[model samples]
Target: MSIGAVLAQLRGDFPDVTISKIRFLEAEGLVQPGRTPSGYRQFAAADVERLRFVLAAQRDHYLPLKVIKEQLDAADSGAGPTAALPRPPRRLVPIDAPAENVGLPVADDFTVGKELRLTREELLEQAGIDAPALAELQQYGLVRPGPAGFFDPDAVLVARTVKAMTEFGIEPRHLRAFRAAADREVGLLEQIVTPVYRHRDPEAKSRADEVVRELAALSVTLHTLLVKAGIRGVAGC
Candidate 1:
């Protein structure tokens, strides 16, 4: 079956499942669907079953992707899909606390490329925000559609994060600072990269891409550390 057909089959059970979520799971190697010659996904019966198991484990058991993958591996190894799986304890962190085990930023984390093309409704659904909230985000210039009038995948992430922040009393209007900061960072990065990116050498584009990725990672790291330091000062930690 095509990916859309697989999505349709899963939607009755997993209403929150979007194409991006399925693509993310595939990227994580949970379901190894075959690809056609034109690079389209083709889900076999086994693939759909694997997705069912993964989604069920996540919804019913709150299993993380790592644990879910281990279970899938065990099943693939003839242990049966019904084999017992381990469950990790979930912990709640304070809102002001930095996340645990964030680790060091990596270039790949900031690599700006994706194939997602979501409609406005898909973005709202995936982001868990209502139409009014989306309009607010647009008003603040925090979220935007691409030239093709479809949202980039990152917009979903941005909208989701903004929604979560709203729980802390942060409004979309207040997020303008964030958008401005990001714009400034992008402008700075562009100034630094455009020269190398426009070089006459054959390898210029590749080298420029690598440089931008590394710089982007470093910029985020710097911003995170600064925020942590400021928070510590504010909280007298």
Candidate 2:
């Protein structure tokens, strides 16, 4: 079967599947189709099945390609079945619904855990972004590495989110307002915490930290609600 035949076979199940997406999966080494002497892709039945597995894992399970690849590799090695893949632990909740413990904010919620550091290649793979996309994100200040030249988990999240946003025709330059808004919000939060943070008493400093965490949570909630309201108005909901 040619690549086009493979696409036709999967398109009924995955309406959004495209030749480009299939090519990308091949580039990521998730699928290995044979190439003819003319350099045209020659997909086998197993290759089509593998593409289905990858697409279904992404759509139904929200598994990253890296994890999906690992599962595929494990399956190929006869280690385990891909059906044993893990699902996200948390319940899927509606956007309008308040999450559990919305009022209680913990320090862990505000801090990156374990001081994780990833190289550029790792960040790209985890974030599912290419170098040019990453560069554009950095150009817009939407994603940045630390002074030590390593990216944190937050950078990965930002790059991934921006990549998804691009599907709706949103570009990096269009996200500048988001960066500006975040900076302004952080500045305002700082103003409220600076005095408490400066107290000579250690207890005051601790209290300031707690306050910042709580306020950070509230700020995010407020922003989400405001955006929801505005979107509803726009949608006449």
Candidate 3:
């Protein structure tokens, strides 16, 4: 089956799981599915069940992927992962309620920013940046105005980063690469969701929204981990 089919199958229980998360697990050698001749991922019934095991272990036991991968390896070698893999049932989220209450901060794109919309001056002050610097960041797409033509609350944090980077002589033009990378990441995620997103099914739309949120969170987690690892290596840790 396709990844979308697996996602729709598991989303009833694991609402926050995304295709990115599944692919991440696969990368970590937790669950390996086969590939088709056309390069599409093909998941078998066993693949889906193994994924359920991994996600359940993560959510219920808070087991790190390393340990889970070990369990999977053991299972593959004839030791069963069923020892600690509990298939606990979770109550389904109501269809009417928004699915994006993932505890992300206000500036995340998942939430509407109509409230606390900041003007240019307000954004500058909050971000601790001057008007000219703000214009530079805006010009390069490092930051953007909100849907209502005001700055979202997250703009202040973006400005803070920009201001600090400027002190290191990193100009807005130099930061344009970050914006470009972000756009590319967004495109990759959209490709995963667009098929399910455009479907007429309400559940499909909900799954698509949840997948985007989960993927965004996963991306941030990965970025933070890589940066921290780089810093550790630089410090000879």
lDDT by residue (40-118, candidate 3, tens digit) is 9999988888898888766555455666778888888877644544564763343243544343321124533356789
Q: How should the candidates be ordered by lDDT, best one leading?
A: 2, 1, 3
Of candidate 1, the 10-residue stretch with the lowest lDDT total is 86-95
Question: What lDDT tens digits, residue by residue, belong to model 2 across residues 1-237?
Answer: 998999888755664467988999999999999999999999998888889888776655545677788889989999968454333233223334454424433232674348789999999999998999999999999988899899988898899898899999999999999999999888998999999878897656655665676567667667776887899899999
TM-score (C-alpha) between model 2 and the true structure: 0.55
- Candidate 1 lDDT over 19-117, as tens digits, reads 887899999999999999999999998788788877766655535567779878877888855544333232222223444415647555665675789
lDDT of 1: 0.78
Clashes per prediction?
A: 0, 0, 0
Give the local distance difference test score of model 2. Answer: 0.78
TM-score of each: 0.57, 0.55, 0.53
lDDT scores of the candidates, listed in order = 0.78, 0.78, 0.75
Candidate 3 least-lDDT 10 residues: 99-108
Top candidate (TM-score)? 1
